[model samples]
Target: MLLPLRRALLLGLATVLGQIVWMRLATGQVAWVQVAILVGVTAALGTVFALNFTIGHLRAAREEVKRLGVNEERVRVARDMHDILGHSLSTMTVQLGLTRRILETSGDAALAAGRIAELEATARTALSDVRATVSGYRALSLDSELAGARMALSAGGVRVELPAATDAVRPELREVFGYVVREAVTNVLRHSDAELCTVRLGPAWVEVTDNGSAAGGAEAGNGLTGLAERLAAVSGTLEHGPVPGGGFRVAARGPTAALDPAPSKEGEPI
Candidate 1:
């Protein structure tokens, strides 16, 4: 906020000082007209400086809002984790206590053994969930991604069209597609002012098209650049261009072998 104002002030002061020196050198005396011109120039520069300052302040405020939103999401995730694990651990502890009590009371070895097995399974399941969450390697399901895209577009009041059964995309291709979908949705939310968004998946290609203004000169942010790198990693290609009728389209393609099957409840094989 202050940076732009400071810069403008410095520029205006320099300009005014230069003009004063030039006038002193060129003329014997400083006239009232020169004084009025200097005052007017200073006022105009100050107004421009104020306008630039306001823009900077607004940008800072927007960034602060985004930061606050991210913080809120983190808090919500932590609370959910605490609730889930707390309950699971409490139940497991109770089961263990019961098993111990049975062993001491009746020496019922068979029942105690079964209870111990149950406890072990529960603990293992909880551990698996925690590991999955921490690893951040979520299984990418094409169907789920399509559904999510549909929901997002609908919520944005944009109509969506999807094609029929697409082939089982390769594991690597699926991951890349996941990133493409994410970036496309983000662009729609942030930049597009469209009445419709379309997602099409074919045997060897996936495309996202929106009926919004073209984003030709817009700068690609880190998210899109990172996604492009991911695609490049698998020898896949990503392309963005303007559509004939209007708006923009993003397409990504790669070998089908890149897609992986959904992980089983038993978890990934070691």
Candidate 2:
């Protein structure tokens, strides 16, 4: 391929030769009027070429922006669905197992029926959440997720210690923290054999700790990965690993700010 500068020089030389040949053939001499006409034609062709180049660049840029928007929406939908289905299915599995155990040990139809009802409610809520996610209208509530964590943990036969209220958490941080709590509790139920699970909340942080070792099941999964992304969107960080001696802990910490002057008290056992 010719270098750009060489190509332009060659084209200019060719155009000069072609114009000289034309002038000699048409009038046997160059005239200012003919020269002006040639210049005008060349200028018009150059303007057309520039306009076409510019239009092509603009079209390419528009397509790139459209592709990026589609990819972003896909990521959002996948994350929301992962959060919804992971927790709901995990809760149902635990609840179904509990109902089976209750039926086997005591033959209590009423108790089993009650557990089934709870499972149905959870399923219905999950369906609603999925719909909301698809419509791009879903916003998680810290309070609701905490209630869900309590129910799910209890069904899994794990003792839970949770804050009496989430009022201490900053308003802007609550949604991401809600995601943190949901993902953390789901992991504890599916991956741990803990006897006690505790959730601590503060103005800029939330932590979920379980007394059960993960038995090497502490690797980050879809839930944790999505949770980390959600936290990162809010300038927050996610930390998860085995505790000093045993068990596992997952925490999301946001930027340090004086959102609360007085710190929250310790969570009470429920």
Candidate 3:
């Protein structure tokens, strides 16, 4: 393309400048000294031109790196926001709807008031989490996400069967798995009509299964896409699809970093 032409033009210009210097310094006839001077001048000019090109290229490369870094940060923020706000808003909607129904059927002011208070607390916590995520200070834990998933599923009227502990999962993968749990549960709440949701944990994998009829036909949305990317960053894999007969399953498996020699069943779904 144009690169070789540019290089040729630079070299040609440098040679022409060198020839002019040689002519000005010529003593009417060429000699060995003059030839040597011409060669030296041309080499010097070529070096100068080459250095200029190199510096220009280096500057461009630096700018490209900076731009790429900014883009990466932007992507990270967008994904985190989607995960945070999406789940929070969904939860709030479900809670409000459920509260309204309870009030309509039972006419229990005290119960409705208590549920409203809990919803308020959830909103506050979600706000705090959003702030933390924006400030790059948010840290997700498997245990906390498990608890949140259980609460969210139950609130959505899905009977949850969640692991009692996270001791079997690898420490480094806990955060990623936490994200998986959050997104998976959120999917169940928002997209399914499952009555039973079960979460199973192993040394290097976590699976969320629900008896939702829509499992086979569910499309891959932004949540699942981003979750897959996040897991891939740490050599982890995400598998999500309909089960053999009549359920949806989302599973995340990380590189084996188990604490136990064999997979333990200590954190089986309760």
Candidate 4:
């Protein structure tokens, strides 16, 4: 390869130049001034070559790191898409199958109409979720998630309580927390038989705990895993486990700095 040849050339040049300088000095044919100038020039050229090589290597390394990071991000996005679409499609399939069964057995127009309406609603919800996922900027905030959780739980006849003094989460981190809250609430609605859910936010962390038996078939779906990855991307963490008292709990944490608000941009007059 060209690398070996280049290295060999440099070695050969160094050896020959060294011998020539040595011979010139031994024969007294070269003046001290000339020797000094020649040595200084050689040193300067070596330093330049070294710097050039170092810079080139560093640039190559930086580009490779960037490429790897981009690939990782793409993979993460693909996984998230798969999780969201796959679950939605599965639920839709079940609903459609139920509708078909109802249509085949009963010629009841009212029931058929109701099924159709449900299907339409499900489709719309799925479409909205897909849009949000694709946009990447459709991140929900913590306060919004809290409100949504309360509404959803109350609709399900589950009593809910939230903390009074929640920390002011950063915009990016708040989005991640919102996703976690949404996912937890969805899981509870779909799986748990609980009548009570509590959300607590403190200086250390935020947790959503439910007082229901763990569903037999419930597992950490791809959605939850994706949520974890998203949290980690913003230097946050997600933890989930069974609560000793009865139900399940999901929590996320970040540094105190992350909870601070951005400085105001107010200016004196104009």
lDDT, each prediction: 0.64, 0.84, 0.81, 0.66
lDDT of 2 by residue, 1-270 (tens): 123445755775587678878888988997767666766776577667667777999999999999999999999999999989999999999999999999999999999999999999999999999999999999999999999999999999999999999988889999999998898888889889999998888788888888886654478778888888888888888888877667888877787633433222222222
User: Candidate 2 regions off by >4 Å?
Assistant: 1-44, 257-270
Per-residue CA lDDT of model 4 for 112-190, tens digit only, reads: 6776776676678668767876767454467866875675566456799876644645455666666776777767766
Q: In angstroms, give how far residue 17 of model 4 lies from its true place.
A: 12
Better of 2 and 3 by TM-score: 3
Task: Kindly report which residue pairs in candidate 4 clash with one another.
Answer: none
Per-candidate TM equals 0.44, 0.81, 0.84, 0.61
**Best lDDT goes to which candidate?**
2
| Error of model 1, residue 240, in angstroms | 0.9
For candidate 1, the clash count comes to 9
Model 1 stretches with alpha carbons more than 4 Å out: 1-134, 214-217, 255-270
Model 1 lDDT at residue 3:
50
lDDT string for model 1 (1-270, tens) is: 135666866876787777777778888555658767877877786788778878999999999999999886675445334433543464465567778888899999999998788778767855765666555443545675566566555545578786555465555576568657656765765577777887766544567777898574156665556556667778776677666667777777675423523222222211
Candidate closest to the true structure, highest TM-score: 3
Residue 198 error for model 1, in Å? 1.3
Clash pairs of candidate 2? Answer: none
Clashes of 4: 0
